[model samples]
Target: MNAGHPIPGPASVLAGARVMPVLTIPSATMAAPLAEALVAGGARCAEVTFRTPDAEQALEAMAAHGGLTVGAGTVLTPGQVERAVAAGARFVVSPGFDEQVVSRCAELGIPVIPGVATATELMRALRAGLDTVKLFPAEPLGGLSTLRALAAPFPGTRFIPTGGIRAAHLAAYLADPSVLAVGGTWLATPAHLERGDYEEIRRLTAEAVARSTS
Candidate 1:
């Protein structure tokens, strides 16, 4: 995180991106085209997960595309946070909460949405001045039922539920006022990228955008 360049708030980022496409790019070369396809389909933001060897390079490429606000996902360490910010990530998302990672992002002035599946973790995030968090493994944790339960006690807290979410689940998730957005890998599957099916990717993204808005 650079002291001179502050990232946008998570609320602002998610507000514009009701359907945040979570991407796992295999190579740097595919990043720009993927970004272009997503943007052409009306996506405002995306997350490049650090699950592949070229994750950072891919993130850099997507960020350079200049259309969608790109961020780093699956970030687990403070070191990865620094790398993600250097690669032009506007935000950082972790599969779970980490005090060190949160501190590092705060030090760099980057918005971070750490995952929380329990009230204890949610309390920790709230105490740290974070009102937004990701409800990880959302389906396995009980889907909208779980989301409603967690959000009941915290009126102003916002959530961005991710994991195992599909097109059919979008409407129900977004219908909750507590949800800032939804993150999913369905928009750009690995097969779509492997086959260089940018059109399919574009169509999926457009369909998601339509679902989120409608």
Candidate 2:
């Protein structure tokens, strides 16, 4: 274990999942129910972003639930890496590429997917030994067309487009082998999670899975 870190790398985190629902934990109470509901809907994995103070607790809560894979998103610092791994996060994702964060995650044995919006950032991530990366604010970065263009030079790289993705965009993205998975909040909106609407979460997850795989 590098630096005493124990979890496997990012490939394990992806786990062939078509959708990695980006989630915000409003409270610890929302973690387990949301995890169970996501698994019930066929998306057995979830990405709880470190966008709030509740993130660490929520990551811990979701990781405890059986049969669900939990990841930490919006990770930006070595401190966050230590916190996430301590909280049982198997993987970490950042808004933009940061060598320090990626290196820290590597030492801790947690897989990381850093965001890259251009060839330069992609090259940097690739140089960091990351074959897969997230495209931040994916739509404004040019969406699938942009992704297709970016991938032309790096055929072996895979992407997890995280921003602005909707149910309608899933099919096209998944159809391309370069897209490992799609991440977004639309699958489990804050409103649904806040209201404890697990059924809606499950239903949306199921449709997303179906659409992506179909």
> Model 2, range 1-214, lDDT digits (tens) per residue?
1344433446676677878899988888888888888889888678889988898999999999866788899888899989998998888889999988988988876788999999999998887777889988898888999999899999899898989888888888888888888997998988998788999999999999888777
Q: What is the lDDT of residue 161 in candidate 2?
A: 92
- Candidate No. with top TM-score: 1
- Listed in order, each prediction's TM-score against the native is 0.95, 0.94
For each candidate, what is the lDDT?
0.91, 0.86
Evaluated at residue 24, the lDDT of candidate 2 is 86
Query: Against the true structure, candidate 2 has what lDDT?
Result: 0.86
Name the runs in model 2 displaced over 4 angstroms: 1-9
